[model samples]
Every structure is written in structure tokens, then in C-alpha cells.
Target: MAAPLTLLLIVAVTIRAALYRSSLVDIISERVEVVSPLTAWKRVVEGLALLDLGVSPYAGDVFHETPLIIYLFHFVIDYAEITFMLADVITAVALYMSAQEYNKQVFRKQRFALEADRYPMDCIELIRSPKEMYYIPLKVAMFYLLNPFTILSCVAKATCGLNNAVISLFILATIKGNVLLSAIFLSLATYQSIYPLTLCASALLYLMQRQYIPVNPRRASFWWFVAQYAFMYLGSLFVIVGLSFFLLGSWDFLPSVYGFMEHPVFLIFMQLAVISIFKSYPTVGDIALYMAFLPLWNHLHRFLRNIFLVSCVLLSCSALFPVLWHLWIYAGSANSNFYYAITLLFNVAQILLVSDYFYAFLRREHHLTYGLYLKRKDGSEATLVLK
Candidate 1:
């Protein structure tokens, strides 16, 4: 199993790496054309740097939207169009399998080895007891490794779910009760986009689990989380101040980078997401579906967290885009940022459906693993695993 898995992983990664490298050529050149119906998708993403330059001497220069890691800015940020092409493409693929493998490895190595028994008796409780003889798919997501959704999402990178892979690691860590990891990832996700908060439902899990056993509320692990977010947003606040002074005139009408919270359209969608999360609790997969679509809430700067949240609400209100486009065409309301906002919305929706599919398949694999477990057990207390 190890050798074959290793070989397959190698082959899969190689193929993906080659494709991403090729995509880089087009992305860097802006040769990656914005297809229509999805035209708003293209422009909105492209608008950020453009708006940043509106009042500056660089306004005449074309702005680029290739995403680059914050630390890579020394060489990349000034180039605009030549932004993080290679990174985004590679990160996209890495997000798919790397995330799957990372999560599964965490489970197999840290989870089952310790709490060997009481697995199917209660999947959640499996974390506490040290015994054997049951199987649980939630302990290891089956479809994540085998499923082609990651490939599909990669082939279709324009969407939010695909773009969100790296960041989703953070969201998932939060779900699994890794605080420092979650906060760190959340900070990264918050900077990447404001969309991750929709997955905030995972926070409920964290709060509950923290109190479940020996976790120390007073430990630095607990307070480390507070400081991490404090710094992330505090840094964002500083950026907002600088941006405020930078875009003094456009502050009122222009869409904010932190618009995930306050944009009219974004607000509505976020509310719907929250409601859906709570309402769908009865169905295991429904909450998963709701989460898969929640986009990242990043700070390009210039607004409050609340404001950014609202913008997400508006952009994701896909129902209003026709009117928005009409307004743009009529020179009424559309700005370059409008396109950016809407594309983020489209991406979120794409991720939701696809993620649910992956999660569902994981559930199916759980059923199969359990069937095997029932047959293999000697009815003795000892657990029999594939290994």
C-alpha cells in the first residue's frame, strides 16, 4: 500500500506540476482570456491593483491580478500583471492532494494508534478511548485521496473552491481542533480573502472540544490563538489606514478590499450561509456543503472585518449580477472591483457543490471500511486493520 501510494502520488504530482507550469506562461502574459458569462469574474479580480493606482502616478500602467505570496512582494508586487502565476498554478494542485494526504496522515498516525478501539461505536468518541475493533471513515476521508474532484477543481481554477485549497487546510485544522494551526491558517486565509469565516461553524467544534478533556484554558496554546488573530487584523487595520489616506476620494463609492463583510450583496449571502449552516445541522452533509462554498475573506485593506463580510454577501448574490452588469454597461454602478467581487462569489459556489461531492464520497468509503471491519473482527477485543 505504501509503495503504490507513493508511486501514484509521484505520478499525479508530476502531471499536475507540468500543467501548472504551462498555465503560468499564459497567466503571466495575461493571455489567459476572460471568457464571457464569466467576464465579471475576470474583471473583478483584475480590478484591485487598478483601484490601488487610481490616484497615483502609476494609474496609467496596467494592473495585474496574479496572486503572489505576501513575502514574495519584493520582486512581484511592482510588476502587477506578472504576479504569482507559477505559485497559484502549483498551489492549486498542491492544495488538492497535499491537503488530502496531510489530513489522512494526521489521522492514521495520531488518531487510530492511540484510540484504537471504540471507533464505530462513536466516531467522535474514538478520539478519547484507547481500544480496538471498529472502523470510521471520518477518521480518514476515503474519497479525498481517490476522488477526482481536486483534479476537476484544478482544471477549473477560476472557481473559489479550487482557489481555496491551500486556505482550506487552515479551515480544516480549525475543525479538527488544532488551534495554533487554525489561527495561523485563518490569519493566512483572512489575508487571502474573507471567505473562510463562513466555515466558522468549525469554531463551534473547537470551543466544544477544548472543554471536552484535559485542554488547559490558561495555557499559551489558548492565548496564542488570541494574539494571532489580534495581529492579523491589527496589521489589516494599519493597512486600512494607509489605504484610506491612499484612496481618500474613492472611499465611499469604491468597493472595499475588506468588503466580504459589509457589501450589501455579500452580507445577504453570508447571512444565508450562516442560516443554512445552523438549519442544515440535521443533515451531516448539508453543513459540509454550506462550508465548501464559503469563500476566503482576505485583506487587500481599506475596511473593517464587518464591512468585508458584507461585500461577500453582495458579490455572492449571483441573482443580482445581471442588473449589476446592466448598470456597468449603462455607466451607472459597475466599477472594476465589481467584477472582482462577483468572481469571488462564483468561485465560492463552485467550491460548495464540489466539496460536498467529495465529502459524500468519503461517507461512502466509510460504509465500505465498516463492512470490511465486521467481517475481519474475530469478535475478540483486538482490532484488525489493513496495516
Candidate 2:
């Protein structure tokens, strides 16, 4: 049922303008401008020359910071159509895999595990009747149908390199008890994009819960917790060091992470993380999505993943509108703000839209409650009167 929508998302991203040749050089130029300010002017001048080349010398310029794998797009991804479509296909696969995991947790494990004897995790769970086991599928089916945020965030990473869908899949694999594979995926994810290093969050969480592996003979949660955070902090420190070596220019700004903490958006991003955890808590999939979005934070330690993954790009775009407009008005870049505002608006729309899907899951639960109450035979119960 979800397969077709997954395909549609891939198709849409492949056609977006950002994937085309015309914009590739410019995107690289922006990065170069940020990292190598000295070369910014020279690169811009040379960048302009690409416009009229005979064989188009500039068409195949190596992206100094990007891997050859991503650079493969230069030679092959000719049309905007091909780019979006390919992105969609990649995203569709990643998203479905994520959804499969979610299904296992929410439907197979948690839903099945509960019984009248087991105290409920929340109030609704305690109060509700047996509901007949068959309804679990109906509920899960409804969630997959409505979970926009889950779909978009999964999709966005695949399309835009907004985050590493590949690495995310790897992290999910680890949480699913594939530790050796997780290690390999983790290394590859780091190599692919520096930001996925924050996947430490999920790694730590998994290790704490006894799901992560070291093949330890002793099963002490304390030692496991220590080892997990020890690795998390250690991995984080080294990943930063590695990025500093590779990105070289970012070395200059590393101090800022420890310095001023004045930005309001910083708090907002943190709040979003906190809120998301409270709302759905972290499944390995949810954690991956959160880690992916972390890089989009307005900070240096940001993850390589972002909400613009092939899935979320469109939905995020819708939310970006007011956010960027306010930024444009403040930055006073009235002349150049139009495009920037448009880009941001789209990103925001996509995120909120995706989130709406999760909230819809909760709504489905609410609807169930509402339905059961409506079917109550007692006349007073229908009037919202005390039982």
C-alpha cells in the first residue's frame, strides 16, 4: 500500500532543480566560498567561464570536498528529471525500510506484548478494552497511511544528501541487532558525510537498553552505559577531528561550539528534539531521523543529514515560508531574500507536514477512544457525564 507513495516521492525529487547540472557548480561554489574565502573570487570568475565553454571544461570539475561516488552524478545526471527521479527511488527504499522497523516495534512487539495484566505505558493504554487483536493492523495501517513526517524525512535524506540515507539505514540495522553491520555502516556513513557521526545518540541509547552488542560475558547495564557514552564522546571527538582535517577550513570555527550560546534558534532546535522525543520517543528509526536533522541546526556540529531528504523537501518547503520571510525582513536582504525565503519556506512546510502524520497516529488512537465512547449504550455516558 505504501509502495506507490514511496515511488511518487522518488519521482518528484528526481525532477527538482537542485539536482541538475546548472545548479551543481553554484552549490559547490557556495561551499568553496564559505571554506576558501581566498579562492572565492577566482572560483566565481572561473565558474562564470563554464557558461560558454566549447566542450564544457567546467562541466566535470572534481568536487574537492565531495566524494567520487556523489561526483558520479556529474557525468550521468544530465537532466533535472533524472536527478529527482533517482533521488526518489533511493529515498523510497530507505523510507520503506524505516517503516518496516516502525511496524515491528509499534505493531508486532509493543502492541502484542500488552495485556490486561501488564500495566499500561500511558493512560489510554490502561483504560482501553482488549480492542480485539485484529484492530492493531487496522491502527498500524492507518498510521502508515497518514504519517507524513516519517515519509518525508526518510525520503528527503536520500534525494538531497540532505542527510545520508545510507548511513541512516546502517544505524537502523545496528539497532535491529546488526552490530557488526552497524559498525561498517557507521564508518561508511562518516566517510560519506561528516555529520552522521552524531549517530552516537542512537548508539548510546541502544547500548543502554541492552540492544547494542559487544558480545560481553558480563551483562552489567552500568558498564554498558559507561562504554556506550565513552564511545559516543570518543567517536564524536574524533569525528570532529577528522572533519577538521578533511574540511580544514572548519577548523577555524570549532571554538564557536564551546563559546557563545546566544542564538534563539539554537534553543528552538533543541526544543524540537526534546519535543519529538516526548511525542513519539525514539525508535531507532526516529533517532536516525533526528540525527539526520541535527546537521541542519544553525551550528558547526550540525549533522550531514537534513530534513530536505528527498521525502521532506517538499513538505519542509511549505513550512519554510513564514520562517524565511521573517528572516528576510530581519536580514534586510530584500533584494536577494526572495529565493532564500522560498527555499526555507519549502523546508518548513515539509517538516511540519511530515510531523502532522505522526500526530495523526495519535489522532487515530484518539478516534478509537472517541468511537468506543460513542458506542456506549448508557444514556448518561453519551452526555460526557461522570460514570
Candidate 3:
């Protein structure tokens, strides 16, 4: 795994380095789908210039990144390309570790269930084998590192890579049962973009589950654990916010950075796609994070209804985005409506993809619990319908 991961990193780095030096770097950086205003390298450069001139980066409406980001680039501006590449590497590695840890937990639970004879005899076919689970983490890393969206985001130097790294670290920490580190990374992620704040509840729920704490409202232990995690998360967030203010000596960033994104409902896996579509300024980097998780749910493929159709739609949209943008902005043959129509279709496709996966996952769980062939009380075949 180490050798393969290292080779993948090398290949990923080589590709990014090549693109960074090519004529397409500028074009890639300017693409609206690849680099949004909030995460754009160009705006980061502008912010760095403002900071160098003793002016606030947020004084103008151009830069909306957090203060820590501006200062981070201030020191490493010369190696911006390397920094973005490193961020992508960190994200992939973290996700790999996370997937590995999660697989272990799942296998452990399945073993326990088997020992207890909790699953139906007819559902034996649904049991996962070690061989099938072994390559999931590696595939997860490969998916992320080799994903065209991830590659483009890295080449464009989008800070969305940094955000993904933070979120990935948060996930790794959560799965590894390090409460404090999870809270810290979660805070950092939320601080980077308000959208990640929704992950707090999911992380808390996962941590509680790992600790064998039931979610009964009457349990003092449950409440205590919740309070403890909340305090750590909020405290870490406060410290990060305070440090930002101390660095800049003002609260100007509050409105400029945190105020830019909308808050959505908490559906951990689906939230990433929602953010990518609904954020004030979205980019391909945001979509890469969610798409990387698809492999983790590969077992649900047999139950998925629209996987092929959704895949076709997503691929078509990805290719047409540039063509439509070129027509609208450069060729002047198409209008904003033309490009926006594609954007709407792209988002709808993503929503359908996420929804289909969610349904498939639920169906798999149902089958695993009740047996593959469900029957009614009268011995007639039964069907499950989602409202």
C-alpha cells in the first residue's frame, strides 16, 4: 500500500507540475467551474499584494478567503504550486487512512453480527469478504488523486484543496477516535468555509457510536459526551477565530469570509455535493471531495437505479462546461442562459447521483437485515417503496 500510494503521489505530482508549467495553467485557473471567486488563486494573489502593502485583504470585495490563508500564502507564495499539490496529497492520504479505519470498523461490526446470528440465513450472500474490502482504501486514494477535478483544482492552486485536506483530516481523526484532533480539524475546516460546520453533528454522532454510547435522551453519559465534544469543537473554533482577529486586528473577515456561504441541512455524504452546487462561488474542487467517496459505497452499485444515466450526464456536463463557457464568453455566439442551462443540468445530475446512491445504500441495509427476498404475511412477494 505504501509503495503504491507513493507511486500514485509521484504520478499525481508529475501531472500537476507539468500542467503548472504549461500554457493551459492560465486557462485552467480562469475556468469558473475549476476555480471559483472564493477559492481562486488570482484573488489570493491580490490579497497577498494588499497584505504586503499594509492594507487589509478584505478591504475590497475581491478577496473572501480566511485571514490564515492570506498569511499562509504570504510566506509560501513562491511555492504556491507545491503547496496546492501538497494539500491534494494530504487529502488523498487522509481519505485513504479514513477509508481503511472505517472498513475495519465495518468488518468488526459485521463479524459481531455474524457471531450473534443477527443477520438472516438467506442474507449470507450479502456478507462482504476480506479480499473485496482490502483494496477499497487504495482505490479511494487513487480515485481522489487521479480524479480530473482534483488534478485541475491542484493545478489552478484553488484553496478548495486546502479545505478538502482539512475536512479529510477531520474525517480521519473522527474515525481514528481522536476526539480532540477531530474537533480541531473540524474547526479549521469550518473556519475555512462555513459549509463544513454541518459536519460537526455527523462527527459527534460517529464518535458517540464508536464509544458505544447510545443516543437515548435520558442517558446522562450521552449528554455528557455531547457537551464535551461540543465544548471542544466550539472552543477550538473560537480560538481559531480569535487568532485570526489577533493577526489582522479587526473583524472585517467575519462578513467577508464566513458570511459568504449558506448553511444547509446535515446529510454528511450528500452535504459535499450540496455545497459544491449551492455555495456562493462553487468549483470543481468541491465536487472532487464527494466523488471520491463514491468508491466507499461500491457495494451499493447492484441496487443503484440511475448510476449509468447519472454517469453519462456528469461526463457530458464536465466536457460541455468548457465548450459552453468558451461560446458564451469568447465566441459570443451563446448567452449566459445557454451556459446556465448546462450548469443547471449539471447540478441536477449531481443531485440525482447522490440521491440514487442514498437510496441504494438504504436498500442494501434493508436487504442485509430482512433477507434478500422479502415476503409479505400472506406469502406474496413484497416490495419496498421510498416516499
Candidate 4:
């Protein structure tokens, strides 16, 4: 594990170091498709400057990052590049360790279930063998370290890498059954970005599963467990938010950071619907989706088909983005509509990629439980219909 991880680190560092030395770093950092309002390194620097001058970093709307992040860079501004690189490395290592631990737990549960005859005889084939799970951690680490998005983010010095690292650490702590560490890391992630609050659902589910607690809402034990985790998550979030308030002496961040929560649940849903319906910048959505959870879907790739087509579509989209942007922004030969058309195509390709894998995963699960081939009542072959 150390040798392979060291090799991966060497490769990743070489790529980043070369990019840093090249003239492309500046160009990549300014691209809208690569940097956003929240994760842009430029804004972080701006905030740090204001902090150094004893001014509130949030005085201007230019800095949208959380207070914690600004303070983090205040002391380490000179080592920004190294900080971003270390964040990426930390994220990869945490994810690798978490994956290794998770596989062991899953295999142990499977063995116990088999000995207890908990699974149907026909479901035996669905059971994963130790050999297949052996290198999953290494593969996960490699996928994350070598992923193009991660590389681009690192080279550009986008602060998204830090957010990802925090979330990855949260996952690692959670999988290791350290409730306090998990809650703290999770709160740190939520402080950086509100999107990670959704991860609470998965954390709760994993904890419950680890305890062998059935998810029955009517049970007191189930409710007690939910309350316990919820309290820890919310308590930590509250403390962090209060600290931010004390640091800034202003509540301006409340609206910008968590305004989505001001409304009732139905209103929140409506707000999201409105944003989706009226959004003019699909690139933001595309990048957010791709960067966040794409690696987690690696296991579904083997079950999917049309890999060649999906690969081509994705690669073509990646290449075309800059070209289309150039034509629209500088060339002015192409209009917004032209750029948008490619954006739409890119998003559609992403949808197809995810949907195909989803379909394949469901189909594979069905085949594993029931026989791989199905027959109709009249002895004719049957086909599976998603509808």
C-alpha cells in the first residue's frame, strides 16, 4: 500500500509541479469553468489581504468563502500552492483508508450472513469475493489522485480541494466509527459549503447499519439514535457558526451561506425549482456535479455498457468547452446561444452517462438475485422493462 501510494503521490506531484512552472497556471485559474465564486483562489487571496489590513474579509461581496477559510490562509498565504497540494493528498489518503476499512466490514458481514443462511441459495453469486475487494482501496486512491478534475483543481489552486479534503476526512472518520471525529469533520465541511449538510443522511444510515439498528421510525431506539447523531451534527454546526460570527462581528454570512434554509421545506423545494428553471449558467451545475461524487460511482462502471460512447462524449465536451468559450467571448463570431447549445449537449451527455450506469447497476442487481436470464410463464424469454 505504501509503495503504490508513494508512486501515485510522485506522479501527482510531478504533474502539479510541472503545471506550476508552466505558463498555463494563470490561464487555468481565471477560467470561469474552472473557478467559481466560492472556490476561486483569487477571491481567497483578496480575503486574506483584507484580513491582513485588519478589515473584515466579508466587507465586500467579492469574498464569499467562509471565515474559517480566510483565517486558514492568513498565516499560510506564502505556501498557498503547497497547501492546496497537501489538501489533495490528504483527501486521497483518507478516502483510501476509508475504503479499505469499509470493505473489511462488508466482507465480515457477508461471511456471517452466509454462515447463518441469511441469504437465499440463488444469491450466492452476488456475494463478493475477497480477491475482488482486495485492491478497491488502492483503486479508489488512484482514481481520486489521477482524476482530471482533481488535477485541474489542484493546478488552478481552487479551494474546492480543501472542502473535498474535509468531507473525505469526515467520511473516513465516520467509517471508522469515531462519532466525535466524524461530527467535527462533517461540521467543518458544512461550514465551508452548505451542500455537505445532505451528507448527514448517509452518515446516519451508516451508523445505524453498523449498530444493526433497523430503520423503523416507530422504534424508540431508532429515534434515540437519530436524535443523538442529529444533536452532534447540529451542535457542532452551531458552535462553528457562532465562532464565525465572533470573528467577523457581523451576521452577513447568515444569508449568503445558509439562506436556503430560511424557508419551510416546501418553500425550499420551490426555491430550488426556481433556480433550476431560470439558471443561465449550467456550467456551474455541471462542474459541481462532476467534482463532488463522480469517483464514488467507479464501481458502477464495470456494470455499464457503451463505455466508448460515453468516454468520447465526455472527452469531446471537455475539449469543446474552451473552444466554444473562445468563440463566444473573444471571437464574437459565435453567440451565447451557440455556447449554450454545446453546454446543453454536454449536460445531456452527462445525464446519459449517469443514467446508463444506473440502469446497468439495477439490471446487475436483478440478475444476481433472480437468475441472470428470465423466462415468461409460457416458457418464452422475458425482457426487463424499467417502466
User: Which candidate achieves the best TM-score against the true structure?
Assistant: 3
- Alpha-carbon RMSD of each model: 18.0, 16.2, 12.8, 13.5
Model 3, 283-360: lDDT tens digits are: 788889988888887777889999899899989988998888788778999976676677778878887997797677
Off by over 4 Å in 4: 117-125, 210-302, 375-387
TM-score of each: 0.34, 0.40, 0.82, 0.73
> Whole-model lDDT, candidate 1?
0.36
Model 1: residues >4 Å from true position, as ranges?
Answer: 1-5, 20-163, 210-387
For model 2, how does the per-residue alpha-carbon lDDT over 189-238 read when each residue is reduced to its tens digit?
A: 65644444544444444434411212121111222233445657455444
Candidate 1 residue 65 Cα shift, in angstroms, is 5.8
Clashes of 4: 0
Tens digits of lDDT, candidate 1, 309-340: 44455345534544455555467777534643
lDDT for model 2, please.
0.37
lDDT, residue 318, candidate 2: 40
Q: In angstroms, how far off is 237's CA in candidate 2?
A: 17
Q: Rate the local accuracy (lDDT) of all candidates.
A: 0.36, 0.37, 0.75, 0.63
If both were scored by lDDT, which would come out higher, candidate 1 or candidate 2? 2
Q: Pick the candidate with the highest lDDT.
A: 3
- Positional deviation of residue 208's Cα in model 2 after best superposition, in angstroms: 6.6
Number of colliding residue pairs in each model: 37, 41, 0, 0
Which residue pairs come into collision in candidate 4? Answer: none
